[model samples]
Target: MTTSPALDGPLTTALVGTRRFFTRSQVSDDKRSIHTEGGRSGDAFYRDRWSHDKVVRSTHGVNCTGSCSWKVYVKDGIITWEAQQTDYPSTGADRPEYEPRGCPRGAAFSWYTYSPTRVRYPYVRGVLLEMFREAKAALGGDPVLAWASIVQDPDKARRYKSARGKGGLVRSSWDEVVEIIAAAHVYTVKRWGPDRIAGFSPIPAMSPVSYASGARFLELVGAPMLSFYDWYADLPNASPQMFGDQTDVPESGDWWDAGYLIMWGSNVPMTRTPDAHWMTEARYRGQKVVAVSPDYAENVKFADEWVAAAPGTDGALAMAMGHVILKEFFVDSQVDFFTQYNQQYTDLPFLVALEDAGDVADTAEGADGPAYRPGKYLVAGDLDIAQAASENAMWKPAVLDARTGDVAIPNGSIGFRYGDEGWGKWNLDLEDIDPVLTLHGLDAGGTASETARVVMPRFDAYDGKVAHVMRGVPVRRIGGRLVTTVLDLMLAQYGVARPGMPGTWPADYEDPSTPATPAWQEEITNVPAEQVVRLAREWAQNAIDTGGRGMILMGAGTNHWFHSDQIYRAMLVLTTITGC
Candidate 1:
C-alpha cells in the first residue's frame, strides 16, 4: 500500500506508512494510544492540556465574601477551562488583608461550566423523535402489544378499578389528586367554621405560598386565630399581668442615665446579650450594680452585691425593705420629692387619718361633703440639709378644722393647705388621730385630710418605724397602691416634711390591695420573697443615695415568671418612693 504524505509528519505519522496496511479495527485500537503519550495526535495534546486546566480550576479554592481572581484558558478561540487564582485579587484591585475573594463553593465553577448534564439547547419532542429512531426501534412491539391488549377488552378497561391482574392497575392523572385535595379543603372550611380549620398540613414543612394562603384565609374569615403556643398548650397568661403589656418595664430610656443599676430576678449578662454590653460599660464607669434573685447567675458576677432570696416572697421582702428605708433615714433626702410626685406617699398618714376620723365623702360636693381622692405631685422643696434648715428656721403650732379643711397658721409661720377644699381638719397634735383612718378617709376612699392627718402626725413624731407600719396598712388595704411605704418612713425619719412646701394631695385613690398585690401574686409573677426585699432595699438605697438617678434593668428571666407584672409594679413603687 502507498503512504500518504499528509500522514508522514510528526502530527500524523502514525496514520501513514505501515499503518496504511492495517485494517480499520487495528487503526481504531492504535488510535487510542495517541491519547496516552508519544502519539502523533495534535488533538490529544490539546485535550490533555484542556483537561489539566479543568482539574486546576476544580481544585482552586476561594474565600467567601472577599476579592478573588478567576483564570480562563482558551484554545482555538474556544474557552476550554477556568479556575480561581488565589495569588491575585478577585476584583483585580487592592483589598484589605481581612477581605477574602470568593468562597470554596464559588471556586469550583467547573461543575457549572463544563457539566455534560446541563441543557445546552432547548429540545422539542418532535426533534427528539427524529433523532432517536434507533431508540424507537428498540422499544419494538411492546407499545403496540399494550395498545392491542387494551383494545381487545373494553369491559376490562371499564372494570379497571376492580381488576386484580399484574397489569390491571390503572394510572390516575395528577389533576384527579389535585381535585380531591381542593374538594377536601372546601368541605372542611364549610363544616368546621374557618377557625376550626387548621390550614397547615400535618407535616411541618411548608411552602411560602401555602403559608401566605393560610394567613390570608384566617384574616379574611375573621377567625379567632390561636398562636403556636396555644396549639402546643405552652402559652402563659402571666406576661400581660406582670409587665402591663407583653413585657415588663416601660419603653422609656430614663434608666440608662441612672447612677445605680438594680437587677431583680434578671440575669442580664447571660440573657440580654445586647443590653449587657451597655451594662458592662456602665459598670466600668463606676456605676453600682446590685443583683437580687433566688438563684445566683452570671449577671451576679458583675454585681457589687447579690442577694439570694426564697421564692414567692418578693412582696413581703419589698414591705420589709420599705420599713428599713423609712425607719433608718436611709431615704430621707429623697422623701420630699417622693411625697410630691408619688400619690401613694402623699396620701399616706394623712389620708389614713381622715378615713379614720370619718371626715371624707364619697360623692363630689354632694350632701355628704368633699370626697377624698388619691393625689399625685412633684416635690418642690430643697433636698439639701441647708435647704431644710432655712425652711424650718421658725416653727409654730397650727390647727386646721377637719370639716372646713382650713389650716390656721400662727402670725410668724406660714399655714399650708392642699386643693380647693383646703386642709379639712388638722390638729396641732396629729398623734390624737388614728393614722390609717385619717389617710384612707371615712368612705374608705383616700382623702387629702386623711393623708395630712396621718402624715403630719408621723412627721411630728419623727419615728420611721411607726411610719413604716402605718404606710403598709394603707397599702395593704388598697390594692394597686403605686407608692412605696418605705418612702413614708424615709420622709418621717429624715424630717423632709416642711409645713409650707409644695406637697399636694392627688385627686385619685389607688386601691393598693385589689389590683396591686393579689394581682401581682396571681397574675404577674411568683418571685422569691427574699429577692423582692433585697431588690426593694437596693433600689431604695440607690434612689436615696443617687439623688433619684437609680436605674433598674428587668430582663426576660424575671419577666418570664408567673408574677412578672407584680415584679414590675413593685419596681415602679420603689422608683416612685425614691422619686426616680
Candidate 2:
C-alpha cells in the first residue's frame, strides 16, 4: 500500500510516528472510555524522574516554625522527591505521638532549590553598582573611598536609595559582593561609629552558620546585634513583661496535656498544620477546646465554643473574663489551690506603698474613703525587717506574714540573688513564713470592712480613659507609711466589687457602665455577656478540677497589636488567678 506523503519523505522517515508502529485502540462498548496497552511505555520515562540513587535526611531551612525531618530522594546529584520521616520521638505513653509532622509547603519546598526564581548567586542593585563603578574609577580603585563618595553625595544617595524596592538588580560575583559589603561597613564605621552599624539576620535555629558568622562579624566591629524578634515585630512582648522571658512558653506537644484549651487568635489548622492534630487528639481525651477569634477561622470548626470578639478588642473580652474569675474564685470565695499558688508563685502578696495624691486634682474619694494611687512595692529598706539596712535590701519586697501578721521581708527576692552573696536563699522556698495572699479576713490596723479605693491604669475604659474602682484593702501603718498588698490593688484594678466596699464596682455582670463587667465588655468586644460569663466559669472550673490543666494557645496574631503587652497581660490574669 502507498504511504501518505506526510510520512513518506526521507525527512519524515527519521521521526518516530505512532501511526506506523501501532493500531488505534478500540473504544469501549459503552463508548465512555478507550483502552490502550502499548502506550504505557511512555509512563516509564516520567517515572524515571522519581527513581533515586540515595535518600538523605534533611529539614526545610526557611523561617518555618515546624522544623520537621524530611527524607529527600535524590537522582544522580539532584533532588527528585521528598517524604515525611516517620521516626519522630514518642511524646509519652498516653499522649499522641509526633510523627509525619509536615505541611504542603514543606512537601513542595524542594522545588525552590532548582526554581528559576531562586537566587543562586549574589546580585547588586543596578543603579548602586553603576554608581559604585563610576566612583571606583574616579577614586583610583579604592573600594572604601568609592563607597564613601556615593553615600556622601545627597543626589547620588537618593538616586540609589529611591531605586530600592523597584527591583533592578544585576548578577554579581561573590567576591565583588563581599568587597562591596566590606567597603560599606568600613565606611559606615568611620562616618557614624560602630554603634550605628547594627546587624540583623535570619533565625539562628534555621541558619545557624550564617547567623553566627554575621553575629561574630558585628560583635568584632563593635556593632550591636539586633534581635530578629523586634525586627519582625514577633517579639511576643507579653511573655517578657509577664514572665521575665521572651521564649519561656510550652511546646506544641504540651497541648495534649491541657484539659481545657483555648486557641486565641491562632489558626492552628491552617497555619500550624503540623501541630493541629494535637488539638483534635486532645479533644478525643475529653479536653474542651475553645476558639477566640473575630471571624469564623479554620480552628473554630474544632472548638466546642467560639468566642467571637471584635477585632483587636480581645483585651476587653479577656479583662471581662478576668473579672468573673476574680469574682467567683478569688473575691467571692477563694479556691484553696488558687490561694496557695498565688501566695507562693506570684507577686500578689507583695506589699505596695500607697502614694499620697494630695495635690492631684483628679483624685476622687469613694463613698468609704479618699482614693489613693498605688506606688512602688514596699521593700525591706522601707521598714525595719530582719534584713533591713542590708546591702541591696531595697530589691527585697516585704509581705504580710500569716503566722505573725507582721510585715516580713522574703529571702528569695532579687536583692538576695544580685548584690549580696551572704543572702543565699534565691529560691521561692517559704522556709517558715506563711505569706498571706489577701487581707480580707486577717485584720490590719482597721476593721475588716475598711478598705482602700485606688486609681490604676484602665486602658479599655471610656474613650481610652482611666478607671477607678473601690475594694476592701486591709492596710498597715508601718514606718509612718501606709501599705497594701498587690492582690488588693489588682482586685481594684479588675473592678471586682469585694464584700463591704463602696464606689464604682459593677452592680452585676449586667451593669453596662462598669469598666470590666461582661455587659460593659459587650460594647467593646462585641462578644455576648452570657458567653463571656459561661466561658470564664467553665475555664476556672476546668483549672480547679484538673489541677491547672487549662491552657491558651496564643500566637503572633494576638501579640501584634499596639498594646500587645496589655492585651496578653489581661488574658494572663485569668490563668494566673486560676493557678493554671
Candidate 3:
C-alpha cells in the first residue's frame, strides 16, 4: 500500500523502448549481475491468463475401458485445459496407486474435439445427396418416395455406393438426415423385413445414452440392433465357447494378483495403455512376465522371458505347453488341486458313448464288443435314471459316483438348465455325488469291453501331412452300452504319455515323433522345445504355489487367425490342466 523512498520517482526506463521498468533491487557480491524489482509484473499476466471460471469432471470419448475422470478447466464457458483427477479410491497398500489415470490421447482430446476434420453434424455422400435431391424435387418432397426412387434405380444406388469412402461427403441438416434415415428404415422394412433395418450405434459401455436411444428406436421399429461387442473379426470366439461369455477375463485390477503372467500375443502397453502400469507394478513386486510373440513387441520389453514363436503357430505352441502341463502336473505327478478341479469343474468325468447316436455296430457274438465311433455324452435318460418331478432327464448327464459306485444323474448338466424354467437348475450343486474321473477298472455285471483304439484325424503342422493318430482308451459295458469316461479319451487325445495309459503319447518333451510335443511344436512354431518345457513347468509350479495365480493375456494377434478358436482352446486347456 505504500512505496519506499527509493521508489518515489518516475518509473525509470530500465530497458530502452520497452514498457518494462525495473529498479536495481540488489547487487550481487561478484558485481557481475543485478537483481531487478519490476520483473514480477509479468507473473500477473500469466496468472490471469491461466485462471479459469469453473472446473468440471469429464471423460474422454476415446472408447477405452479406463473411463478416467478429468478436471476440465473452463474460462468464459470454453474448455481451457484438462487435468487428471487424483481422488481415485486406493486400490490397496500393497498394490501401486491408480492416480493420474489419463493417457496422452485423453489429454489431447480437447484439440481433437476442435479439429477441422472433426464431423460436427450429419453428412451424406455427395452423389447420394444429389440423387436424393433430384428424387425429392420430382416426388413433391416426400422423403420416402425420394429415397425409394434413388435406391430403386440400380445405377443410382451403385453410383452412390461406389462414391462412398472417397471423401465426397457433404454437410447435412439434422432434420433432413433424420427424415431420410426414418424413410430408409420404413422402405427397408416394407421391401425386405424389419430384420433388414439394422442399427449399429457402438460402444454401449462408453456412450450408453446414445446407444440406448438408437437401440430404443430400432426396437420400436422392430429392427435388429447389431452388436459392437462380439461380432468383429478379432472377437475372441473361444471365450464364449469355453466360458459362455463374450469376454471372460478378470478385471484389470487382478493383474497385480498374478504370480506368473503370460502375454500371449497381447501388446498390453499399446492396446491397453491405461492399465499397462499394473503389469509393470506387478513385475516390480516380483511377478514373472513371459511374452510370446514373433516380433519384439512393446510388451516384450517388460517381460522376463520372450518366446519368439512363428506366426500363426500359436495353437501349436499352446498345445505343446498343454502337453507338458498334462505330462508333468497331471500324469507324472497328480497334483491334488488339479485332480480335484478336473473332477469337479471339468467335463472329464462325463461318459461318452462308444457308438454313434441310435447306431450300435455289431461285434463278434458275446465277445463284449461293438461300437466303432464315439457319440454324444451318455445322459441319464439312456440309463433309466429317474429325475425330479418336471425335470428334463434327457438333458442330465449320467456320471459314475465313485462314493456309491452307482450311476448318478448330476443336478447341474445342460439338460437341467431348460425344463421347468423360472430360474432353472444352473447351480453347481454336486449334492453328495462324487463323480469318477476314469472308468478304467469299473465293471457293470458283465465282461468289460476290450480297449478301443480310436483314430483321431491329425493335420501335421499345416504342411499338408494329414494323418490319423490312434488313441487307445479303456471301454466298459454300462447298462448294455459300450462307453468310456471323457478323461480316458482326452488323455489319449492330448497325447499324454502316462504310464499304463495307452495312446499315441509323446515319448517326452523332446519327442518329435509324436504330435503336440514340445519337439514337435518346435518344427511348427520355431520356438525352442526347452523354452516351452521350462515355461510350462514354471507356470504350473507358480500356480501350485500361489493357488492358481497364473494368468494369460491374449489379444487380436492370436484371435485374428483362421484357427483362433482352436488356439484359444489349447491355451485354455493348458490352464485347465494346471488348475490356473
Measured against the true structure, the TM-scores of the candidates, in listed sequence, are: 0.35, 0.84, 0.80
Predicted candidate 3 versus true structure: per-residue lDDT over 1-580, tens digit per residue: 2234455344522322122234435544433344555766768855763699999999875567678889998888877788899999998777788777878888888778778988889999888888888899999999999999988999998999999779998899999888888889888898998988867776776688987887788888888887765444545777778767777455778889999998887898887777889899999889999999899999999999999999889998998888878777765667888877777777888888886412222221112232255678887667844553335666777778889877887666677676565154577777798888776555553323367755555677357755565566777667778778887777776787533444456667778977788999999889999998999889899988998889988777776667678888888887776677
Q: Residue 321's C-alpha lDDT in candidate 3?
A: 86
**Model 2: how far is 486 from its true place, Å?**
1.4
The numbered model that scores best in lDDT is: 2
In angstroms, how far off is 537's CA in candidate 3?
Answer: 2.1
Stretches off by above 4 angstroms in model 1 are 1-217, 225-256, 311-316, 322-334, 343-538
Q: How close is candidate 3 to the true structure, as a TM-score?
A: 0.80
**How do the residues 387-444 of candidate 1 rate in per-residue lDDT, one tens digit apiece?**
2233332232222224443222222122222232224422233433222212222233
lDDT of 1 at 61: 25
Q: What does candidate 2's lDDT look like per residue over 1-580, in tens digits?
A: 2346556565544332333345565444433344555877878966976788999999886777678899999898988889999998877787788987999888998788889998889999999999998899998999999999999999999999999999999998999898899999999999899999978867786699988898888898999998777754633667777766766245788898899999987899987888899999999999999999989989999999888888888888998999899898887787989988888878899888887554341544243446677889989888866677788888889888989878887666778887655456887888888888777766543346456656654455447755444444667666767788888877777778766555667689999876788998999888999999999999999999999999988766676667766777887787887888
Cα deviation at 379, candidate 3, in Å, is: 2.8
Error of 1 at 136 (Å): 41
lDDT of each: 0.41, 0.80, 0.76
Off by over 4 Å in 2: 1-46, 91-93, 123-180, 232-234, 246-248, 357-372, 389-392, 418-424, 444-453, 461-473, 499-503, 512-514
- Evaluate candidate 3 by giving its C-alpha RMSD to the native, one decimal: 7.0
Instruction: Count clashes in each candidate, considering only residues at least 3 apart in sequence or on different chains.
Output: 80, 1, 1
In model 2, the worst 10-residue window by lDDT is 12-21
